[model samples]
Target: MYHYDEYDRALVFERVAQFRDQVQRFTAGELSEEEFLPLRLQNGLYLQKHAYMLRVAIPYGTLGARQMRTLASIARDYDRGYGHFTTRQNIQFNWVELAQVPDILQRLAEVDMHAIQTSGNCVRNITTEAFAGVAADEIIDPRPLAEILRQWSTINPEFLFLPRKFKIAICSARQDRAAIMMHDIGLYLYRDGRQQMRLRVMVGGGLGRTPILGLQIREGLPWEHLLSYVEAILRVYNRHGRRDNKYKARIKILVKALGIEAFAREVEQEWQHIKDGPAQLTEAEFQRVAEGFAPPRYAAQPDGDLDYGTHLAMDRSFARWVSRNVQPHKVAGYASVVLSTKPGPAAPPGDLTAEQMDNVADWSEHFGFGEIRIAHEQNLILPDVRKADLYPLWRLACEQGLGTANIGLLTDIIACPGGDFCALANAKSIPIAQAIQSRFDDLDYLHDLGELSLNISGCINACGHHHIGNIGILGVDKNGSEWYQVTLGGAQGKASALGKVIGPSFSAAEIPRVIEQIVATYCAYRELDEPFVDTVARVGLEPFKERVYARQPEVSTCAM
Candidate 1:
């Protein structure tokens, strides 16, 4: 994890002081709500349905034990006893008091963390794969560049206020776990013919009312010019992106209005002047950032543990967990364990109690380096857990209700804090997610169904990234009543594709059964060993749509 230097510390503390004063002024009636809106948003404070929500950035989803402990402390002391881990690789305290926000920011600063850029129409948190350095198949570790982008964008005067919120994600693995193509700016880091690091830049990709996959704009971009290149892209968008309408303000809209070729041409024209500017990364500067993410020390152990295999054979439950929760690590004898936040009906998706956070933090230190990772899927990850100690760690995790063996299963849902908390939401997301999880509570059935992603967004904002889920459920407003619209064939990774809507929306009570019917339809149509997304793609959405709506009531006519 990247530790803050004096400069980082100074900037955060100063920002905290500034926000403290801003809050005081707003409370004193010296500043209007409109005036304080951006100020509070920049500091990661949002006035939600019932209370203020504070979103704290976990840079590139990496967290040290101390930072995790501090987050747990904040959750316990400042707001509710739990916090929701978001799809953006950040955490949200949903019940925070308005007056206590500065104190929260100050507390976060103490641990080299803050809510800066977590919200607002500025560049938000730069996210990457949860298993960046540890992934066995990763071509390069993206943390250094992710951290660089984080620092560069933080409070950058040029991009402080873009037409809309900008998001950038980097992925270096063969599998695009970072969902790079779904970002405003996505970078795929790789090497060229001369073994020189380069990037493949994708632009205009976003999920909202208008969901579109990013188009590759620039290829073989030298790694040294990352900052300058990004600056050029931002310059293009800032100049031409719509300012009149919030819905049309996104770079995706601009890119759509002007084709990718013209957009690329503009960016290229803009880049020539600044290509060799000071922002061009030097070898030394690269090394300085890279040093922060250097691999942790590891003990010499056999490539495969006999005891691990023995334990798996002995306990079917443990074996099932290993198959799902545990992922391959780059180093021998190490595994990355995903602690599922969606554990049946006990908790909503991504909601973790303060005690659970502290326990995971403890386990990160106990089982691996004192590090934790937040996956974009709203799960916690211990990136370097030893295979030899897997059983003990699994037992401890199970005790804490974090040992749900559904990593990519249907129940491992990715959902937003919808109408329950977010004022922007149209319908409640948590209850829907909980209902689905409860319906699919059987671990055997989930595993048998194979890998599947079910994502629900309360609205078209796509906060849950529903467009890329194998089965995407979006809450829609129909006569002031809660309804869900389902989509199929969406997928993330190397073959990322936006899902297509099946048909009409269904009522909230009909969602669980609709999902069950969808899954059943997939089971009937799928080829042997075919993944859910692949099956949906092969057969199309008609089969599932028919099944979901068959014998169903006329939901469109229903009123609240």
Candidate 2:
């Protein structure tokens, strides 16, 4: 994890004080609701359906024990007892009081965290894979470059307010766990033939009303020009991205209007002015950032644990969990464990209580380094847990309701807090997600079904990233009622693709059965060991669509 220096500390504290005064002014009627809107948004405060929601940035989804504890404290002291981890690798504290926001910001700042750039139409949090450094297939650790981008973008006067919110994600692993192609700017760090770091830059990729996979604009870009290159891209977008309509303001729209070739040319032309400027990274600066994320000390141990295998064979439940939740780590004796936040029907997806947060912090320290990672899938990750200690950690995690063992299964859903909390939501997403979870609660069935991603979004803002789910469900407004529109064949990773809509929207009551039918269709068409996305691609969406709308009259598709 990157520790905040004096400058970072000063900037955060100063912003806190400034927001404190702004909140005071708003409360005292010195600022109207309209006047306070942008100011509050800039500080990551949103006036939701019932109360204010504060989104705190967990930069690159990395958290130290102290930072996690501080977040738990904030959740305990101020808002409701729990917070929701978002797809952007940030956490949202819903039900926060307007007046207490300053205090919450203060508490966050104390732990070297802040809500800065978590919201507002500016460059948001720079996210990366949860297993960035520890992933077995990684060419190089991306956290150093992520940290550099973070420092460069944070409060940069040139990009404070873009045409719309800008999101950038970096992935260095062979598997694109960070969903890089679904972001405004996606950077893939890799080593060239000479073993020097380089970037493959993807632009115009985002999920919203208009979901588009990013196009690779520049390949094999030297890592030294990352900041300058990013500046060039942003500068082009800032100059040409639409401001007349919010829906058309994103860089994706600009990229769509102008083809990738023209867009790349414009960026290259712009890059000529700034490519070799001070923003060009130097060896010392790179090393300075890289030092913050050096690998943790590890004890020498055998590659595989006999005891771990014994425990797996002994307990079927434990075996199931280990299969789904455990991931390969770069280290010989270490493994990354994803603690599922989506335990069952009762809990909303990606939600954790304050106590759960504290327990995870304790577990992170007890099991490995005092470090925690928030996966883009809305799960907690202990990146360096010893294989020998897996059973004990699993037991502790089970006790806390964080051991759901549904990592890539249907039950491990990605859903936004829809009409329940968010004012922008058209339909209630949580209940729908719960319905799906309840319908598919059997772990064996889910595991047998295999490696399926089900995502739901309340609206087309795509907070839940429904566009990329193997089975994507988007809530739509039909007349005055809420309905769901399903999309299939979407996937994330090296072969990322946006899902295609199956057919008409269905009522909320019909969603689970629809999902069940979709699953059944996949099972029927799939070959041995075929993943859901692969099956969808092979057979196309026609079979699923035919079955889904077989009994019901097709309702007209509407805006999600």
Candidate 3:
């Protein structure tokens, strides 16, 4: 985990003081709603359905135990005793008071955390794979580069106000766990034939009113030119991206208008101006940031734990949990564990109580080093758990309700806090997610369904990343009521693809049955051990659509 330098501390404290004044002015009526809107957004405060919401950034989804404890304290003292982890690997406190936001910001700053650039038309949190440093298939750790980007982009005057929010992700592993193809600018970091680091850049991917997978614009870029090349891309987007309509403002829209060749040409033209400028990353700077992510000390042990094998052989439940929750680590005698937030209908996806946060913080230090990670799937990661301690850790995790053995299963649904808290939501997302989870609570059945992804969004903003789920459910607004539109064949990773809508939206009550039918259709058509997404691709959506709409009356499709 990266510790804040003196400059970092100063900057955060200064921003907190500045925002404190802004909050006071707004409360005093010195600033109008329009006037305070941008200021508040810059500070990561939003006026949602019930109250102010504060989104705190967890850079590249890494957290120290102390920082996690601070977050737990904030949840306990300031707002409700919980916070919601988002698809972007950030956390949200839904019931914050506007007047006390300064206090919360101060507390966050104390832990070297802040809400800066978490929202607004600036570069949002830079993200990579949660298992970046330790993944078995990792080519190189991308965090050092991700951290460099974070330092450069935070409050960068040139990009403070773009046409729309920008997102960047880097993936260094063989498997694309970071969902890079779904980002505004996605980079694949790898070594070339000469064993030199290089980056392959993709541009124009986003999911909102329009969902488009990014197109590869540039490849074989030297690693040193990361900042310069990224700057060139942003300069092109900043200058020509649409300003008239927010709907058409994303870089994806601009890239669509201009073909990939034209877009690449524009970026190249811009790059020629500053390709060798000071923004180009140097070897020293890279090392300075990377030092923060050096590998933690580990005890010497054999490749596999004897006790771990015994537990797996002795306890069926432990075996099941290990199969779903445990992931391979590059280091011998170690593994990464995902603590599932989507346990069941009892909890909303990505949400954790303050107590839960504290327990995880303690477990991180006790089980591994004092570090934690947040996954894009909205789960917590114990990145360095020893295989020998797996049984006891599993017991503790199960007691804390974080040990649901459903990593890629049907019930581990990702959903946004829809009408329950967000003013932007068209319908309630939590209930629908709960409904689906309740219907599919059978673990044996879920595991048999095999590696399915179900994501739900309150609206088309795609906060839940519905566009990339194997079975995507999107809430839609009818004349007055809420309905859900379903899409199939969507997936993320190396072979990412956007889902296609099945047909007209269904009422909230009919969603569980609709999902059940979809699963039935998948089971009937699937070959031996074929994943749901693959099956959908092989047979197409027609079979599932025919079964889903057969008994129900035809209704007009809702305008997205």
Best by lDDT, which number? 3
Q: Rank the candidates by TM-score, best first.
A: 3, 1, 2
Q: Least lDDT summed over 10 consecutive residues: which range in candidate 3?
A: 551-560
Span of 10 residues, lowest total lDDT, candidate 2: 551-560
Each candidate's number of clashing pairs is: 0, 0, 0
Model 1 poorest ten-residue lDDT run: 551-560
Alpha-carbon lDDT, every model: 0.92, 0.92, 0.93
Q: Give the per-residue lDDT digits (tens) of candidate 3, residues 18-62.
A: 999998898899999999999999889999989999999999999
TM-score of each: 0.98, 0.97, 0.98
**Candidate 1 lDDT tens digits, 286-366:** 899999988889998886789998999999999999999999988888899999998877898999999999999899999
lDDT of 2 by residue, 1-560 (tens): 78999999999999999999998898899999999999999899998999989999999999999999998888889978889999989999998998889989998999999999888989999999999999999889999999999999999999998999999999998888999999899999999999989899999999989999999999999999999999999999999999999999999999999999999999999999999999999999999988899888999878678889899999999999999999998989889999999988879999999999999999999999999999989999999999999999999999999998899989999999999999999899999999999988888777777789999999989999999999899998999899999999899998999999988899999998898888878777788888888888889888888877788633321111
Clash count in backbone of candidate 2: 0
Deviation from native of the Cα of residue 236 in model 1, angstroms: 0.6
The per-residue C-alpha lDDT of model 2 at residue 177 equals: 90
> What are the C-alpha RMSDs, in order, of all predicted structures?
3.6, 3.5, 3.5
